[model samples]
Every structure is written in C-alpha cells, then in structure tokens.
Target: MPANAVTQIPAAPADEAVRHFEAELRFETDCWDTHEALSQQADPGFVLLDVRSAELYAQGHVPGALNLPRRKIIASRMRQQYPAGTLFVTYCAGPHCNGAARAAAALARLGYPVKLMAGGITGWLDEGFPLERDAAL
Candidate 1:
C-alpha cells in the first residue's frame, strides 16, 4: 500500500450483493413484458388482482382477473385467502392510479410476493389484451 493511495473495500458476497441490488429496486418498477409473460404462463398459484373500485371494475378489467378492491384488501383477509408465499399481480385504473401500489404494499407487508402491474388496466387495454365487462358472479 502506497502513501496517499486509497484501498477500496470489496462489496459483500455475490448473494448479498444481489439481495442488496434487488432491495433497491421497487416492486412496481417491473415492465409490461414481464407481467404479460407471467400472465401467459397462467400458473395455478398466480393471481391477477384488480384493485380498482367495483364501479370501475364493472366498466372494464383484465380478463380472468379477480376484483379485490384496495379498500377491501385487509391484511388478515388477504393472508387468509392467500397465505404468506402466494404470488399476486395487482393492477388499478392506469399508471396514474395509486390503488395498485397501495394494494401491492398491503400484500407485500403481509409477506405475499406481490408485483404492481406497470401501467395498470389502461396498459392492459392499450396492449389489446382481453377485457371483460361486469365480471361473472
């Protein structure tokens, strides 16, 4: 070590580095491609949750999506419906709507793996994905 030379300390192990990197990334920052791909796979354990109000959901929403309005997404109920490790993708009106973000946060806080659908229902519609009016009871 030479005088006036700075020794840069190495970062944590690769696993730790990856964990830190992922932590810095917001769950809502995922792209539409990822959401579409996941939706296409249609895993039995995966769920698409619409966080918009009933009125809004009745007007239009992603096909096969379940309406679980943000206000009704109580932590206890969510935990009961979908234990800790369930995979959930939440969406609201559009990129402008914060309902999805709130819903995702609520689910994540309860230990469910949740992702906010980027651009929300608006994007889903804009991309020409199937949309249903008045979900079947």
Candidate 2:
C-alpha cells in the first residue's frame, strides 16, 4: 500500500507537536479572537495596528485599529505614542500580504511585545465583522 501525501512525511511526536503549536499561539492571533477582545473587553490590553498605507486604511479597517504604515514603524514614534511594554497586534491586507509580519517584526525589534493577526483584513471580513470606513490617522 502506498502512503497518501499527508502521511508521506512522518508526523512529529505528540509532545513535540504540542510544543510547536503552543509556541505558535504566542506569536499569532486570529480575526475572530481579535474582534471579541476589542468589542467585549473593557480594556483589551493590546493595541491593534493596521499596517497598511494610509489610503488603504481609510478605505476600510478593523474597528479600533490604528493606521500605522509598516514603513513608518519607527522606534521614536512607537515610544512617543505607546508606553513601554505595550502589546501590539499587527495586521495587513490579508494572509497574502506580508505587511502585518513586517510591522510585528519592527515592533519586536524596538522591544515592544508583538503578535501578528493571522488573517488580517481578509480574515476579518470573512468572519463577517464590519470594517470602519473613512477614518484617517
């Protein structure tokens, strides 16, 4: 009998798989969780950042997300705007876009705790969440 593609590669030991998945949760969040946190929590305890260009952001964005372009994620601006130890969640156009990862990396390098919102705008919409329109930074 031939192995199917999924079983072609050996699976990791259960313990190793558990560790890997657990570690991943430390770095990424999904759209639904993000929405719930923002809407339900009195203090969500994290800042949601839309790392797309200002124009794109104005077109539509997650409610409560601040428009901060990835290229503009400088340490000085971050420090001036956000106090130390602030948790930042970054998202971009969607899974196809790397802007969220870029913003998250910049925030991490600047010593801010950061996580990527896995599905970005595409995922948010797919979850049937409404986007705020015409807001400018």
TM-score of every candidate: 0.70, 0.96
- Cα-based lDDT for every prediction: 0.77, 0.95
Mark the regions of model 2 whose C-alpha exceeds 4 Å error after superposition.
135-137
- Cα RMSD (Å) per model? 7.0, 1.7
Candidate 2 global lDDT: 0.95
Off by over 4 Å in 1: 1-26, 29-39, 42-45, 135-137
Candidate 1, residue 85: lDDT: 79
The residue-by-residue lDDT of candidate 2 on 1-137, one tens digit each, is 68999899999999999999999999999999999999999889999999999899899999999999999999889899999999999999999999999999999999999999999999999999999998354
Give one digit per residue, the lDDT tens place, for model 1 in 38-102: 56776645688888888888888777779998789787787678766788888888888899989
